[model samples]
Target: MQFENTLSFAKSLDLKDELSDYRSQFHFPKVNNKPVVYFTGNSLGLQPKRTKKFVDEIMADWGDLAVEGHFHASKPWWDYHERLAEPLSHIVGAKKEEVCVMNTLTVNLHLLMVSFYRPTSKRFKILCEEKAFPSDQYMLQSQVRHHGFEPSEALVEVAKRDGEHYWRTEDILAKIEEIGDKLALVLIGGVNYYNGQVFDMQTITRAGKAVGANVGWDLAHAAGNIELELHEWEVDFAAWCSYKYMNSGPGNASGIFVHERHLKNDKLQRFEGWWGTKKDTRFLMKPEFESTHTADSWQLSNPPVLSLAPYLASLEMFDEVGMEKLIKKQKLIVAYLEFVLREIDKETEGSFEIITPADRGCQLSVFLHGQGRKLFDYLMENGVITDWREPNVIRLAPAPFYCSFEDMYRFGQILKSGIER
Candidate 1:
């Protein structure tokens, strides 16, 4: 599709977009009495208009039914999280029984590591990309230390060459092979948060398993933004927050994936809780733990129903449109954004560079060579909502569900003006 850097062309694309109507479902922030051109769904997604309705239903149920709401309400508070499994599973390309909506991302990561990250004297090192999200870095460092291993020795980092912005896939696979018998776990973000590089999870998973290491992904940026086949990829486990591409509210509940191969493994060690007990006998208070034989077995407690409700609102949108359609539109919009940025680069004589890879999802991280926060501040002051990273990167993500091609074009104009000023 040939893209033109004109408002009419952008509007034409918007008119032809199949998912264009989805924008009306969300509430955008206002600036100068008009909706700002929002492009930060990679950080915190805009709230759906239906979110209030979902939350209100839960509130009303509790008000009228009280304790009986556990069993008598429309969704039944006792099994609220279960309602999200099928839809969430579809989003991540996993079996319904293999997915569960519970807990936050890091909490679920720690829980999954308890079962997958079993280190030994010989195979004690865990391999991951350098500069992973700070939370993941902290989690990996503390997990190894919990088992009395020094992080410096137990954590193996695969980094980019001297001045490169992203790690190459071949380099990552080579590191996996280099670590070989000593690599106990292969854990990395599915998409690099800083560079927006989507890793080849299938190849990485196959390589890790062949080398006798457990493989997992943190899909905070990949889950709803990209096409994931976690079960087919043979990933041991994965976790993601719903606040980003999933477009649930701020700090909402997260989704987890455990391949069917591990569901029936009674020998797998996990931090069990009563919520993980079989649903039929869960209320019996049995002394011995009996697993649910599904991914829910990792759930520590009954989920917070209020937080889970917004996801239900968002997942309904995902189920209706499906990932295939969403991804199709995502690629087109991102390509147009790249084109506009390149046009601006030509006008400015290479003032900034796009550091994100071609295989990325919605986000494009723009590195402003020498002009740092001044340009970023100009964008914000002019009502272009984007994210800024410390050294000199600005991140923009035009979410497929809500952002329009017109928004991208407008951003390009604002960016050009900011650069000129």
Candidate 2:
């Protein structure tokens, strides 16, 4: 479908959208006492309006019920963790038994590595992308060093093809074939954080398994922003933070997925904690660790319920919207932004370049030709809020749930002025 420059085209599309009303549910940040054109959801999501109410309910429970809130409340504090699992399962496209929300992203990554990254003499290498997130890189290196293997030698980074903006599927599959036998585990981001490239997790997982290596994903950017099938793809394990598109607030607790295949694999060793114990026998104070058979068995301690209250509210919205529907709208909204931005680029005769691929998610990574930082600063001054990535790139994400066609129009106008200035 093509959109004309005619104003009616944008208005018509907005009128036709079924999920349009959902935008009102969020608390959009303001600049100069007005709502700015926000395109930074890839970094921090706009807060759900209901998040306050969610937190308030729990706060009231804690204050009014005192120590009795654990069992005396309407939604018992004791089972609050269990209430989140069903809604969360739908977000990641997994069964209830396959996912658990606990811990921060990096900590959960380390926990998963402990169980999945068992290195042997011949098969003792970890394969990841060349420029993974700093957190993932640190965890992988530390894990390798712990096993008495040098990071440079034991950790293999499958580099991007020469002169290419992204990692090719065939190149990664070929590398998997070449190193499968010697590989201990494969951990890569479900989406590249900097470039916003959505990786082929299904293909990557299959390729890793063909070589007998366990596959895991860091879905920090991919979780609420993209549709995932962790269980269907047979990913051995995966982890994600909730602050980005999940709208769970800053430094929110994260989640993990473990395939049911590993449920009975007693050979797999996990870092044990009392929270991972079987529910029925957990408080018995038994010496032996009777680990739960599901993904919950990985939990190290009880989670902070106050931090999780927002996720419960946000995930409920996701359950109502459904991932398939959200993705359909996301593709349209992002494509529209690209179309407008590219049309502007064409008008300027290559004043800017969109470094991120057209196939990428809601984010558009743009490189300004000469005045990158100055232009970014000007946009902020003009009430267009975006994030600049170091020396060149500016990331703009037209989040489907809240950002409107008018917001995109306003951003385009501000961006054009910024480029000209």
Write the residue-wise lDDT of candidate 2 on 1-421 in tens digits.
9865445677788888888898889987788898888888888888999999989988999899987887897667766778788988888989998889899999999999999999988999998998899999999999999988999989989888788768888888888888869988999998888888998899889989989999999999999888898889999999999988888999999999999999877778999899888888887989988868989999988767888899898998998988888788888888888888887787777888877775588888887888768899998888888998877888888888888777776777777777776
After superposition, candidate 2 runs with Cα above 4 Å error: 6-8
Angstrom error at residue 205, model 2: 0.7
| lDDT tens digits, residue span 1-421, model 1 | 7879999999999999999998999999988888999989999999999999999999999999999999999999999999899998898989999999888999999999999999999999999999999999999999999999999999999999898888898998999899999999999999999989999999999999999999999999999999999999999999999999988889989899999999999999999999999999999999999999999999878889999999999999999999999999999999999999999899889999999988799999999988899999999998899999989999999999999999989998999998888
Question: How far is 105's C-alpha from truth in model 2 (Å)?
Answer: 0.5
Model 1 is weakest, by summed lDDT over 10 consecutive residues, at 30-39
User: RMSD per prediction, one decimal?
Assistant: 0.7, 1.3
Query: What residue pairs are clashing in model 2?
Result: none
Task: Provide the lDDT at 38 for model 2.
Answer: 84
